[model samples]
Target: MSNERLLIIDDDVALCNLLSDYLGHEGYRVEASHSAEAALQRLADDDVWDLLILDIQMPGASGLELLQQLRPRLRTPVIMLTGRGDEIDRILGLEMGADDYLGKPCNPRELLARVRAVLRRAGPDAVVEPRLFPEQVIERSGLRLDPGLREVSVDGEALELTSAEFNVLAYLMQNAGRVMSKEQLTELVLHRKLTAYDRALDVHVSRVRQKLAPLVGDGVELIKTIRGQGYQFVKGSA
Candidate 1:
């Protein structure tokens, strides 16, 4: 039995109870909070969690708000639970540093798969190729990723990249000048295949761009959108 610590934050009591029971049976030590605010207080403690299943629609301080407040400090992987067809919330949650999002009314098994995927991404070998080792720190265009430490930095200043974001950057840097399609990124980074109208990859790329812009300054396009293709990390920095 796995001993991963899991936290679920949502207002629906029945939903919470259902997931808690299901996840608990799966061998995870699970805890539930009825509101985002209450979750925030609980999260402030020293008990670090392995993953968080956060619902975007919550009373008093939405999931997005809590995510925003926790960023760069609370680096625990987050998998948001969004209402079906809630595209905006999904994208917002990604921008807020969430590792991934799933449509609500979800099945326990599917949620378990998602949880495993996110946790796998958090590991050192997030991808299949090139392999990741303790001494293997990828460096490109002033950006650095230490797989052993699971840390990324730009120009010597550390970047607070979530697991998803770090995987994106690491893969792009490893294959600079190559146009990596959304499908490829989705599969390699998120440990899932891309679906139609899946803006999750785009939103993550956008967030990476936003975080890198200020550090690298203007006119330096490290990651470029390939327009109808995908994205590429420039072979040479400006």
Candidate 2:
């Protein structure tokens, strides 16, 4: 993990120092910023971050705001640090392109676990796994997904998807028409188990649906949520 550089954006100096020390000792090159301005300036100059740990409650330009700007540009996976019960912040963070979120007062061990999971999902190994979705192109509902290239498009027009979003869409499309249970999807796509209050899967699905909406048209239902089961990718077309 020495080659993996991580940036922590939070106003809590103590927390930053704590994580910098812990993660640094864990073999990850880590950096910290106390505000969004500093983070943004640093990002503009050096956009080579492998992962970012952002606190949603920063003093100015909240983590969600900075995330909004990084999406479709940086594509660097982000794991948001949110307050306990800040479900809204967590959801907004995911919708704004966050790969994962953890509550504050977090245990460095658990944060480290999440960091590993998110990094695994965003790294090259995340896409090069051919066993999950074969190396062939999957075409369904006029949507095309090439697992080898890790590219997706609707009627040949490409769609910009985050690493997690791409994996979510790919797995769902590869098994079109089957309802993928939350537990199964989480473990398969997120590389983690589904925990209580973990809305990550649902939010990730929603983002995938949103990105596929404009290209697939208003009537195309590429992904559908099952009432009590999970989610399914319809075998229909646009």
Candidate 3:
């Protein structure tokens, strides 16, 4: 993981130093910023980080805001840190394009797990054994999904998708017409078990739907919500 550079942005200087020491020991090349402004400046100057561990409640330009600002320009994976019981922040963070999130005061071991999971999902090259997909490109209606390239396009125009969104969409399209429950989707795509009151899967699915909507047309739904069950990709709906 020496080559895997990470940035930790938080207002807590002590915590930043602690994580820098710990994560550095864990084989990552880690850097820390005590403020959002400094973090943004660092990113602007050198946007080579493999991942970002961002605290949601920062001094200025909150982590959520920083994420919003960064998404348009950088595709670096982000893992948000939020206060315990701040379900709203967690949800908002994911919706704002965070790859994953962890509650503050969390166990470092768990945080490491999440960081690895997020990185793995971010790209095939990040993990030891890459998840396999069919070699042939899948197309329905006007939308096309190229598994080999991990790219999705509509009428030859590419659609921008976060890593998590791309995985969910790929899985759904791979099993088109099948109703995949939240538990199944969560485990398969997130590499984590579904927990009570967990909305991460839903948020990711919603993002995929939102991205697909613009390309497939407004009223035509390609991914359908099966209330009380899960979600399904409507084959031929494209």
Candidate 4:
């Protein structure tokens, strides 16, 4: 049995208990909190959780608020639970640093898959494309990508990027100057298909751009939108 520890924060008591039981059976050490405040307290006391399953809507303190409070201090991978058809909550959760999201009333099987995928991506065992192993270190413009180490540095300064962002950036850089469609990127980086009206890939790309801007400088587009085509990493633009 796996020893991965997971913390689920939601206001739904029965749901929490159900998940705790179900996820426990899936070989994860699952802990549940019915309130965001209690979750925060638990996090403060012990921040060693492998992953966090957060609900977007909760009583007392919303999930977004808790996320805003947690992100700056923690780098834990988060998978948000959003209401079905609630696009805003899903987008907001992603923007707030959630690693992944699933609509509420989600299938436990799907949730387990997402959980495994996120954990695998975040873990040291994450797989990289074999093509990228030619040198294990790729440099473009002034940015250096070390696939083996899963690190990216700009002008010799390392930038902190989430696993999802790192994977997206790596794919872009690997195919610099080529337009990678949202469908392709979503499948390759997120290990999922691009659903209609899904903004997950866009949000991740936006986050990558946002994080790179401060290090790359303003007005210089490192990743450019292709106007309905997709995104291309600009080459020769430091």
lDDT of 4 by residue, 1-238 (tens): 7789999999888888888888899899999988899998999899999999999899889998788666424667899999889998787677556889999897888899999999988897754323422135778878998865678999999989866687788888878888989988876655556899999889989999998899988788989999989999997743
Stretches of candidate 4 above 4 Å error? 126-238
- TM-score per candidate, chains pooled: 0.55, 0.56, 0.54, 0.55
Give the better candidate number (1 or 2) by TM-score. Answer: 2
For TM-score, the strongest prediction is 2
lDDT score for residue 132 of model 3 = 33
Where model 1 places Cα greater than 4 Å from the true spot, the runs are 124-238
**In candidate 3, which residue ranges exceed 4 Å CA deviation?**
124-238
Q: Rate the local accuracy (lDDT) of all candidates.
A: 0.81, 0.82, 0.79, 0.83
Q: Could you give candidate 2's per-residue lDDT for residues 1-238 as a string of tens digits?
A: 4669999999999999999999999999999999988999999999999999999998879887787666534667889999999998887677556889899899999999999998887878654323444357888778888765678888889999876687788788878888889988776566556899999989989999888888877777778899989999887643
Distance from true location, Cα of 162 in model 4, Å: 18
> Least accurate stretch of 10 residues (summed lDDT) in model 3?
126-135
- Per-residue lDDT of model 3, residues 74-102, tens digit only: 66788899999999888767755687888
Model 3 Cα displacement at 72 (Å)? 3.5
Reference-based lDDT, residue 104, model 3: 84
Candidate 3 versus the native: TM-score?
A: 0.54
Q: Give all candidate RMSDs, comma-separated.
A: 8.1, 8.2, 8.4, 9.0
